[model samples]
Target: MAGFVAVIVVVDLAVHFYLWKRLVRDVTRPGWRRTAGTVVAAGLAVLVPVTVGATRGGHLWWLAWPGYVWIGLMFYLLVALVPLEVPRLALVLLWRPTSRTSEAAETLSRRQAIARGAAIVAGLTAAGTTGYGMRTALGPPRLQRVQMPLAKLPRSMDGLRLAIVSDIHLGPLARTHHVGRIVDLINSVTADIVCVVGDLVDGSVAELGKFAEPLRGIESRQGAYFVTGNHEYYSGFAPWIDEVASLGVRPLRNERVEIGGLDLAGVNDLGGAQYGDGPDFAKALGDRDPSRPVVLMAHQPVVARQAAPFGVDLQVSGHTHGGQMAPFNLVVKLQQPVVSGFGRVDGVPVFVTNGAGFWGPPLRVGAPPQVTVMDLRSS
Candidate 1:
């Protein structure tokens, strides 16, 4: 599909430039300028779509690139459709082509045309600037925190607090400074335990060396635990797991950590071998004391359905980015049983965060980034 789109774009650009060059030869005046204009316009039109597509990852971006390019073409048509009435009207009045032209009338016509052109340019500029600015300023970043009460609590730790941060895609866009900010924010939160669901890095374990400094600052009374997201699988999971552990962040791969009479289990990406074909949530729980509360950290929330039957009390996940876009919430909805926010699947409770850092575009359109603060309390 990407190949097909690339072919169409290449062909379209070729035909456009070919016709534009022909027009330049036939036209008597300002032909070179028109050719230059066409070249510049085509260049601008093509690059934006490609850039938008390359930046957006996951499956939808794979399909949207071709259609998105055409969307850019529509934006071009909008700009051209704007009427050039003022300049043409001034030409009619000043030249008076139907009658004898006066010197004063000619000067006035030229001045009016220039003034009207400047006004049109200024108005368009202001509109574009205002629209972009408003969206940027008002489009709140997708970050949220929620705490829920537990009806059945473990006696050993009745009111335990847990801070969950996930999808910190540390790469070119999520630099050291951005990560440092998150580290500071997480530290500021009052929690007994910290859990990082997954997608710690977007590219490679090499990224760890750069951002590892901030991981030192992430603090909790118990410790910080991590699980692998699908991105981790693509981004060199082995080295990343080692690097993360070196920073004191325990990467739990189909493993469990006992904390304050509660069982905390971290599973590998459902796609990985550690999960063994398809993960059996009850198996992960094993024969551990069911009387004590069980907290499972799965990168994706679909595990909730299986975990609920096993009496898993709480499951924390962060992969959806909470739809990331307004209407696309439907897509995220269809894929995951739980889209975002807090929900109870049968008997088990699930908390899916939008994530502390963004994956692509560095822009959070609909779902604001979040550091979820969950405090477990006995009923």
Candidate 2:
């Protein structure tokens, strides 16, 4: 990961230097401000790890300051990556504007072009940030309770209300307030069953403790079920499993449970620590009555393709976060069969929620965080 980041940094610096070189050709003395800014940005990137590590063992107040500072600095870094203004600036510097009218006109054209580029960058940045803010602020707290006919569902689940919330990356960004809102949203629906399809907590068990109480408040009729998301492996799955268990959310690891004439099966994350450790669906589900409905929970949507072969009725998953931001949706499409929302894979219905909380950057633009409320009815 460090190597990957270094590669990105190097490419970005190359672009910056390429622009700088071009500017120097046109402008003799463009001043030291741009040079200083570039140097400062690079220095900050280098210091990011050190700065983050320094927050460890710090006071709560002290910790928050660096966090906020880091957030701003990261945003600045993202802005610096815009190819519009920076590249245009470089072009202008590389080509000097002559006093001749034709040269002046050409210079004006270049200036206009650069101005347009800068405007585009500014617009995109503002729109992206605003969209993120709106999603964080005004996005629906949870899935709306809609009564779907039981006849639309598999034969066994005559009338089952399943509330699914995924990708609750509970770290510094998702504080007590956010968790409380999520709990309130979950409690709002009269779901007979609740499924959390992984990424319940972002960091360590200790980080999750801050919002565990509110998470504990999330309610369901039968029970709230959890599966391991990839984040769990990074955050220490063993301790997180115990912590969530204490909160009344049971972790289902390659196991099956019968509920209201429906079989609830779960497997660990496909790309997690217990990837192949769990009982195979075909094996664990073999004992289940095929005439009855089976709802499986896997952390990733990738498992749906496999579950379909086993005659699962509905498979719920997250782990994608619906790309978290824009254009990344294209990237996510290449990875997951079902990026977000309901889709039929093979013979089974798969529902992938965008997620209830965010991961990094604390931003959800095109994809807002969600609490999925799926009502299953007998077919």
Candidate 3:
């Protein structure tokens, strides 16, 4: 944890320093303007870590909102800065011609102004994008309806609606209100089965247990089933598994349950093994009727690689959050086979949700939160 914190601090400091040098220092010459710019940059640099600490400490609860917002803004600005810096670097390195003619001086000034203007535009764009992302994150999750066509699916299970909610990340930023709203929305869907694919809470059960009480009210005909996501392991997996079970939600850890003539199974998240409780696919799928189409819930999409060999009919997962923002989704794709929506691996169909909550940032740009309602059909 100390190493992780150190890395974050170093990266954040570098980004802030770059912003200060390229945008602030260049635009504001040494004067009162420069002094003010320095102060603002320093404040932002401090705010990044301070707010994060406040949130982690669970002190000054109000700081969480601004802290997370700052986090989102900083991340967006960092990405935006990459493109904006290229021209500035070129101007500094390649455009230093010795011809000091009047036209050349005027042209240099105009080009410098243009670069400054571009930096300002990039900053504003990042802020605007962050604001819009926050709105989407705070808003109710969008309902996504999908059809899961399973080969030889039981007739009794046909048209069975399964609601999938994952990656709630309930902590300082996401509290009871968010969970309450989610419960009401999921209840309204009237799903036959509701599956929560893990990463439910950021803190331990002791800290956020009360906030999660709303989950008990989730109404479903077959009850809600949960599987631990990587986040769950990070935040006391054992107790959380028990706490969720107490909430009338079933936590399937390499276990299977028969529901409506279909084999519904869930395995521990892939991260579980790092903590000595890795997913046991063979055990979860063992002793199952091969004729019965199986629906597996594994948190990360990459788990489909294992599920494919088992001939699992479908796998429901959420981790990528569809990159949770633009360009980042491209990055997420490099790690996970499917960022969001439906895809296939080894001919086994998989559905990876964008998730219903934000993680580090209280914002969702390109990948919006979702309450997925998958209607199963026999193909």
Q: Which candidate should be chosen as best, given TM-score against the real structure? A: 3
Candidate 1 off by > 4 Å? 1-143, 273-283
Q: Per-residue lDDT for 1-379 in model 2, tens only?
A: 8998677668656644543333332232345855665575455554444434443322242444445444433443345445454676688888776667689778867775665555445546655675464456335555644444433355655667888888877765566787788878888877788898888775677756756678677777899998888877867778888898998899898888988667889988765645444436666566667776677898888777777777877788888888766656778988888888877777677778888886545566667778888777665
Model 3, stretches more than 4 Å misplaced? 1-3, 57-60, 86-108
Candidate 2 — which residues are off by over 4 angstroms? 1-29, 47-124, 127-157, 273-279
Between candidates 2 and 3, the one scoring higher on TM-score is: 3
Q: Residues 53-129, candidate 1, lDDT per residue (tens digit)?
A: 55433323343434443333333323332344355455546554333556666555555555445445544653454
Candidate rank order under TM-score: 3, 2, 1
What are the per-residue Cα lDDT tens digits for candidate 3 across 1-379? 8999999899988888988876787676579988899898888888888877766624566777877788798778878777876776666566555566666776666566766877787789889999999999989898888887887787777898899999988888888999998888899889999999989988888888999999989899998999999888878999999999999999998999998788899999988898999999889997777999899999999998887778798999998988997878888888998888999877778899888898877899988898899999987
Q: What does each candidate score in C-alpha RMSD?
A: 8.9, 4.9, 2.5
lDDT for 203 (candidate 1): 67
lDDT of 2 at 268: 80
Q: How does each model score on lDDT?
A: 0.67, 0.69, 0.86
